[model samples]
Target: MPSLTNQDWKDLEDSIKAAALTLGYDEAVWDGNGVLEVEGKDWEELTEEQQKAAEILGMDEDDWDEDDEGLRYEDVDWNKLLPEVKDAAINFGYTEETWEGDGEIEVEDKDWDELTDSEKAAALVLGYTEDTWED
Candidate 1:
């Protein structure tokens, strides 16, 4: 093939890719709107124009064979999953205390008006009552 400048190579590669897509060539694909790959085809077999075009495409030299596979794009559904993912994140974040501290008071299995005076005194005996607790 003849020599090609950078811009020439770029335009040629674009033309080849457009032709490949229009011809529905299997295993022929365009990547990044500029690079084209043709399986089982040789740079020489392309018309002299093609070889020069590919060169002008500024696409660096690359090779492929019949064994080469094609690229594919797939779609996904995020609408159904996003809400559940957000909710789970919120549920995982739910907590009462945000600080790390020792000697903090925590009441469990105790209700107001249920403790007898003696139980209350026993609680105070164990330092369960705060010094400034209000009625």
Candidate 2:
């Protein structure tokens, strides 16, 4: 068996604290360093209780699996992207509007106040509601 170093003990303690909160065991709390204290229960008794809880939740801590381990973001390739090439690809074949409608001029030349309520609604992506458009 691998002995848990002081850091590992602390990590385990923090994990238990987080689990209790997430699972709504609101009566429980842990010292910042990871010692557990249930609402009316003893902190020293938690080793046993923690195991039983894990068992009831179908976790076999001794059966170390891939999900038990993970890597930190610090180990990632942060600069794998080049921004200049990305911007150029996005500008490919970009077209400007000439309205191309029989009776309507291009949108860029229109006075916003001259448009109808439905047109205003469309302009704001249907976001123009009484509460939102009040200003």
Candidate 3:
């Protein structure tokens, strides 16, 4: 593959942000560094196309397979979430240092209303829903 020019990178970034908004994120902004600010979402919450854009921006490089076309949600190990996201999850009572590797954070007995807005955002990023606690 040919190397991407600066314009190519910018266009790709824009495309990813557009895709994220289309996928239900209220906002998707790149910090021009490695962080992506997606309103009410996290790495786990991102769809495959969204994640691919993140990869291009250099987040979770180890999670991607060079041989594959792109990373799929199903292929991700939830325990391997980005550091910042994981920290938020831990603070939100989603998991601990020894996560269970269930592909989702433990939320079987937690109440959604009890979780603060920030906590709820963390939970949502980890693929939890209001119905998740009920289930």
Candidate 4:
């Protein structure tokens, strides 16, 4: 992967914080190891009214794991992703195939301006900025 400058890291961190806040997190803290720890209520922690609101929005306990904890963001192994997702990631410059093995993958350089709309949408699903390609 290409080395990110301090400013790049800061911008990425800011974006992550904004996203976490938008997801109803009370706090978002980077652990300095490429992990973001966020404080937020789990499904079980919600009040009755909150639960009803979630239900109204089509959310249910089945949407989450029984042992679910607060949200935490971390790097994903590209090789572990579904084939379609891996293809999208590769198309968007988030991952690349390795020389060895039957196409193992790793993170690659990202060029936000070069991505197509569909690739950008895929990147967004992978927690990248949706407006990176926007003017």
| Best-performing candidate as measured by lDDT | 3
Tell me the lDDT of candidate 2: 0.32
Q: TM-scores of all models?
A: 0.23, 0.19, 0.34, 0.31
Candidate 4: deviation at residue 72, Å? 9.6
- Model 4 per-residue lDDT tens digits across residues 1-135: 112211233455554445433434323122112222221356676666555544543356665323323111223344445466556555645434341124543332436666668766666544456343231
**Model 3 residue 91 distance off true place after TM-score fit, in angstroms:** 1.8
Clashes of 1: 8
The per-residue C-alpha lDDT of model 2 at residue 13 equals 58
Per-residue alpha-carbon lDDT of model 1 for 40-92, expressed as tens digits?
Answer: 36655566555454454443346321222211110112222234332332232
Full-model lDDT for every candidate: 0.33, 0.32, 0.46, 0.42
> What are the C-alpha RMSDs, in order, of all predicted structures?
27.0, 21.1, 11.8, 14.7
Across residues 1-135, which tens digit of lDDT does each residue of candidate 2 receive? 122221222455555545545423432112111122332243333466554554443444543221212111111122321233222212321121211122423432445575465445443431222333333
Per-residue lDDT over 1-59 for candidate 3, one digit per residue giving the tens place of the 0 to 100 score: 11222222345556554644453332212211113245236557667876766555445
Clashing pairs in 4: none
| Model 1: lDDT to the true structure | 0.33
Whose TM-score is higher: candidate 1's or candidate 3's? 3
10 residues in a row with least lDDT, candidate 4: 30-39
Worst 10 residues of 2 by lDDT: 66-75
Residue 35 local lDDT, model 1: 23
